[model samples]
Target: MALHVSLIDFLSVIPRLYPNDPDYFCSLCLLSTSSLCPECQHTHSTHSCPIGGLCDTHRFHIHCLFNLYVMLNMP
Candidate 1:
C-alpha cells in the first residue's frame, strides 16, 4: 500500500516531523524554521520537503519540490 498526500498536507507535516531541530534549514531556499518560513514574502504559505532520506540536514521548500515535480512530469 502507498500513502497518498496532497502538497498542502505534505508540507504541513514536514515541520512537525522535525519539531525540535532549530538548525534545520531548507536545502533549496536555505531557511530555518520550526513551522514555515518566518520571512516568507510569497502570497501563499510555504512548506518544506526533507531531502537526503528522512534527515534534517537537508530540506527544500514545498513550492520548489512542486515546481520540480511539474517540470519532471511535463511531456
Candidate 2:
C-alpha cells in the first residue's frame, strides 16, 4: 500500500527547501525526498520519519535526499 502524507508536512518543507512560494515544486510535481528519523531503530527507512529524531514513526516529506545527506554531514 502507498503511504499517505499530509498537507502540513508538505507545507513545512517549502520553507526549508524553497523558502519562498515553492515555485520549483510546480515544475517537478514531486520534489522532496523522505527518510526515517535516525533515532528510530526500524530496519526500513520509511517506518519512522520527520526531523527532530522522532520515534513517532510518522512520515513527513522534507526537501530532498540531498537535504537528508546534508543534515547527516553537518557538524
Q: Highest TM-score: give the candidate number.
A: 1
lDDT of each: 0.45, 0.36
Cα lDDT tens digits for candidate 2, 1-75: 323444456446644653334233322224323243222323234424424311222223333433444554555
Question: Which candidate has the top score in lDDT?
Answer: 1
The runs of at least 3 residues in candidate 1 whose Cα sits more than 4 Å from the true structure, single-residue gaps closed, are 20-56, 61-75
List clashing residue pairs in candidate 1: 27-59
My TM-score estimates for the predictions, one after another, are 0.31, 0.22
CA lDDT, candidate 2, residue 10: 44
lDDT at 52, model 1: 21
What is the C-alpha RMSD, rounded to one decimal, of candidate 2? 13.2
